[model samples]
Target chain A: MGLKIIVLAKQVPDTRNVGKDAMKADGTVNRAALAAIFNPEDLNALEQALRLKDRYPGSEITILTMGPGRAADIIREGLYRGADKGYLLTDRAFAGSDTLATSYAIACAIRKIKHFDLIVAGRQAIDGDTAQVGPQVAEKLNLPQITYAETVKSAEGGKITVVRRLERGVETVEAPLPCVITVNASAPDCRPRNAKRVMKFKHAKTVTESQAQSEDYIDLTNDRPYLNIEEWSVNDIETDMKWLGLGGSPTKVKKIENVVFQAKESKRITNNEEELEAMIVELIENHTIG
Target chain B: MGNLFVICEIEEGKIADVSLELLTKGRSLANDLSCKLEAVVLGHQLKGIEKQVFPFGVDVLHLADSKDLEIYTTLPFTAVIVDLFKQEKPEICLLGATTLGRDLGPRISSALQSGLTADCTSLEIGDHEDKKAGKTYKNLLYQIRPAFGGNIVATIINPDCRPQMATVREGVMKMEVYNENHKGKVKTIDVDKLLKPEDLVVKVIERHMEKSKVNIKNSSIIVAGGYGMGSREGFNQLFQLAEVLSAEVGASRAAVDAGYADHERQIGQTGVTVRPKLYIACGISGQIQHTAGMEESAMVIAINNDSNAPINKIADYVINGEVNDIVAKLIKLYKKNSK
Candidate 1:
C-alpha cells in the first residue's frame, strides 16, 4: 500500500554565509539582512520522500512548514521539486517559538491535517542545530522516531528499514511504519529542479501572497486548486494560547558576547629535530604534555 | 525544589564519562544555589554503580533498575526521567549530549514543559533579567554555548521553567573525585506504572557488532588540515606526517567542503569536539568553528603561511611555512629521531 508522507521543511536564513548584519542588537538572528534559503538537510529529507513516492506509485508528499507569510516560498520550491501540495502553518501567536513550543504548535496543526503514515524531516536545522523538533513532534504524537537516518533501505509489510549514520559508523535498523524519520546530510543529494515543474508551479501562492498580487489571479487559483497553498493561523488550529510563542518558550537569553580571536606571538622555527626536540621538551616541562 | 539532577547515562554497565563531567560541574552549581546534587542511574541490575558515583559529589544517588532500561530506548528512558521530574521538581537538570541524551532529553523536557538547551559548553548559576519579558529570575542555570555555529558565545537561561534542562558536550567540564569514605543516600525508583503499553513501539530487530571505529575525539594526537592544504594530494602529506607522529587526521570544515576529506574527519563546531593530547595544524586558518572542536588539546602547534591566522591565537607554537614543506620535514625529522 502506498503511504502518506509529510515532509517538514523550514526556510532558514542562510547562517553558513553569515555577514556582519546577521545578528541583531538583541543577539538574535537578523532575518531581514541575510538571504533565506531552504534548510540544506531538509532538501535531503525531501529527496528521500520523493524516492519513496516513486517506488510506491500513488504515495503523496506534503511539504509542511511553519514560518512567516513569506515562508510560502519554501512550499513553492518544494512543489517545483516534486511535492504534491503543501500547508503553511503561519500565525502571529507562533512567533518567537523555541523548539518546545514550535513542535507543540506544529503538532496541533498535524492533528488538523489528520492523515499521515510517515513524517520525514532533517536531522537538525543549520540555524538551531538542536535536532530536537523531529523527535519532539514524535513524542508529542506518541510515535516512534529514527534520527540520523542516512537512507531508507526498504519499506514493505508495514515496516521500514533505516540506515543510521552514528558517531562510530553506521547502523541498519527496522521500525514499524507511521514513524518519524530525520534524515542526515550524508544522504543522497536531492535532484535538481525540473524545468517543466518550475513552469507549472511558478504561479503558486498562498492567500496572503495572492492578496498582495496586482494581477487578478483569483479565477486562476479557483480553476487550478493546486495553485493555492494552504495557510493556517492560531485560530485555525486548536491550540492553547498559553502554549504558543514567547509566552510558552521557557528558554531565555541572559547575555551574548561577540568573540573574535587574536593571534599570539608565533615563533619561527627551522625544520630540524633539535628545534623540535627543544620545543617538545619545553611543552612537556610546562605540563602541556608528557 | 532546589536540587540539581544529573542523568548518569550508563553504558556497558558503567557511568558514561559525560555523566561524571556533569556531576562534577553540577556539584559546584548545587553549592552555589544552596542545594543538593543528585545523580540518576537507570538500567537493569546496575551492578554496584552507586559506589562509583557517590564519590562524584552526589548527595543522593537515584537508581531505576528495571528490565525495560537495559539498553536505552527513548520511550522508556524519557518515561523514567519525566516521572521523576514530576515528583521531584528539581531546579536544574543536566544530561550528557550523547546519542542517548540527545534522543531522550527533548522528550523529557517537552513532557515537563521545561526549557532544554543542547550541546552547552559551559554551565553556571546566575541571576537572569529579561527586559523584554519584564521579569527577573534568581538562581537560574545559565547555559552557555557557542551560538551561530561558534561565531558567538551566548548564555541561555530557562528562568520560567522548573528543572532548567541542558545537555552538555562531552569533556567540556572537568571530572571531580571526592572522598569515597563519605556516605550518600541511595533511592530506587519504580518505572513500571509510568510507562504505557503503546510506548513499546520500537524493538531492536538485530544489533550487528561492527568493529568499533577510531573516534577522533579520543585520539591522543591529531594532525588537522584546512583549506590551505589546496587539494587531496596536500592532505596526503598531512597523512604521512600523521603516520610518523601516530596521530589522527582531522580536517577543518573548509577542507571537508573542498572535497579533500570526508565529513567524518571534520573537526569543528558542527562536526566533533576533540580533546587530544597534542594537536598539529597544517595549512589550516583556524576559525572558531574548527578550534572549538579541539581547543582543549593539551598542546597546539600551527603551521600556516598566514602568520595572522586566528588559529595562531590558541596555538601553543606556530610555524610559518608551506604545509607540504613543513610536513615533509617534520616526517623526516620524526623518523630520524626515532631511529
Candidate 2:
C-alpha cells in the first residue's frame, strides 16, 4: 500500500534582504515591505514527501498550512509542484500564536485528516527560528518525531529510517511509520515548478482567495475538485476556544528597541607584505593571536 | 511562584557550561524579582555536581537523581521537570537552548499549557502591556531574541501564562565561579514517583558521538567566512588560518545555504552563538544575522574587498582587501614570524 504524507508549509516574508522599513515604528513587521514567499526549508520538506511519492507511485501528498487567507498561495504553490490536495487552516482566531498555539492548531488540523503515514515539516521557520512546532505537534499528537532529517533512507515494513544532521555529525536512526520528520536545509533542494503542473494548478484557489476575486468558481470547483484548496476555520476543526489564539498564546511582546551598530574607528592597515608582517608581530606580542 | 528555576544539565560528571551560564543569568533575574534562584538537576548519581550551582547564586538546588534520568532522553527528563514545575509553580524557568533544552522546553511548556520562548539572546525582569487585551502585566520575564532572520529584535514575555519559560542560547552570558562560600538549600526529590514507566516510548539503538576536531563554541579564536568566499572550496582558506591559530572555523548562514559549508559550523542567529576572543572575518559581509552570533567577541578583524562591508562597522581592524590575498599574506607572515 502506498503511504500517505502531509507536508507542513508556511508563507513567510523573505527576511534575507530586509531594508530599513522592514519593521514599523510600533515594532510589528511591516508586511508590505517584504514579499511573502514559501518558507525555504518547507520546500525541502515538500521535496522529501515528493521523493517518497515518486518511490511509492500511488502515494498521495497533501500540503497543510496555517496562516491568513492569503496563505492559500502556499497551497497552490505546493500543488504546482506535485501535491495532490491542500488544506489551508485559517481564521482570525489564529492571530498572534506562538509555537505552542501554532502547533496546537496544526495538530488539530492533522487530527482532522484522520489517517496519514507520515508528517513532514521544516526544522524551523526562519521568521521564528524556534524549531519547536514540528516536535511539539508530534508530542501533542503522541507520535514519534525524527528531527533534523537530512534524508529518508527507507520506509519498509512499517519502519522508516532517517539520517539526521546533528551538531557534531550525522546520525542514522529508525522509527516506526506514522512518525513526524522535520527536514533541515541540508536536505535536497526542492524541484522547481513544473510547466504543466503550474498550468493545471494556476487557477487553484482557496474559497477565501476565490471570494476575493470577481471570477466565478462555482462551476469550476464542481467540475474539477482539485481546483479547490479546502479552507478550515476554527469552527470547522473541533477546537476549544481557550486554546486557539492570543488568549491561548502565553508569550507576549514586551518591548522592541531598534538597534543600529555604530562604526568603530580602525587604524588603516595596508596589504603590503612588510606591513602585514609587522601587524602580525604586534598582534602576537599583544597576545591577540599566537 | 515568585522563584526562578533553571534546568541544569550535567555532562561528564560536571554541569554543562550552558547550565552555568543560565544559572548566572538566573541569579541576576532572581535578584531583580526579589526571589530565590533555584536550580533543578536530574541525572544518574549526580552526587557532588549539585553543589557547584551554589556559588553561582542558586538559592535552592533540586536534584532528582535517578538512573532513568541519565543520558539526556526527552521522556523521563520532561516527566521529572514537568512534575516538579507543576508542584513548585515557579514564576520563571530558564534552560540552555541546546539539543536537550530545545526538546524538553517545549514539551514541558506544552504539557503545562504555558508559553515558551526559545533561543533567547537576552533576558530581563520587567513589566509589559497587553495591547489587544487592554491590560498591563508586571514583573515578567522579558525574553529578547532575534526575529525575522535577525533583521529585528523582539522582546517576548509570557504575561498571562504562569511560569514564563525561555531557552537562552549557549555562550550568550558569562559563566563565572564565585570564590566566596555560601550556604544554599539543596533538596533531593524522589525520582521514582516523578518519572512514569509509560512515558518511555522511544529507544536508542545506537548513538554515534564523534569528537569534532574544532569545538568552535569553546575555541578562543575563530576564522569565519561568508558568501563572499564564493564556493565550498573557498572554505579551505579559512581552515588554513584556523589551523595556524588553533582556532575554529565558522561560516555565515549564506555560506551554509549556498552549500559552501555544513550547517553545524554556521554562526549566526539560527546557528551557534560564539564569543571567541579573536574573530577574523574573511569575505564576510556581516549582516546582522551573521554578526549577532559573534559580535560579542573581544577582537574582530574583517578582511573584505568592499571597504564599506557591514562587518567593518563592528570590526576592530578592517582590512579593505580581497580575502584570498589578505589571508595568504597573514598566514605567510605568521608562519615566517614563528620560524
* Best-matching candidate per DockQ: 2
Q: Which CAPRI quality tier does the interface of model 1 achieve?
A: medium
Model 2 lDDT tens row, B140-212 = 8888887777766789888777789999877778887643475688888898876666555554455676665
Enumerate residue pairs that collide in model 1.
none
lDDT of each: 0.83, 0.84
Pairs of colliding residues, candidate 2: none
Fnat values, candidates in order: 0.51, 0.62
Candidate 1, residues B59-136, lDDT tens digits: the string is 998899988877667777887788888888998999988767888888888888889998887788778677877988
Q: Candidate 1's residue-wise lDDT over A1-290, tens digit each?
A: 78899999998877667676776777666768878889999999999999999999899999999999889998999999999999999988998899999999988888888898889999888777898899889888878888888889877788899888765556777778888899988899888888999999999999988888766786778889999999998988999999899888988776778766655556766555578667756755665443
| lDDT (Cα) of model 1 | 0.83
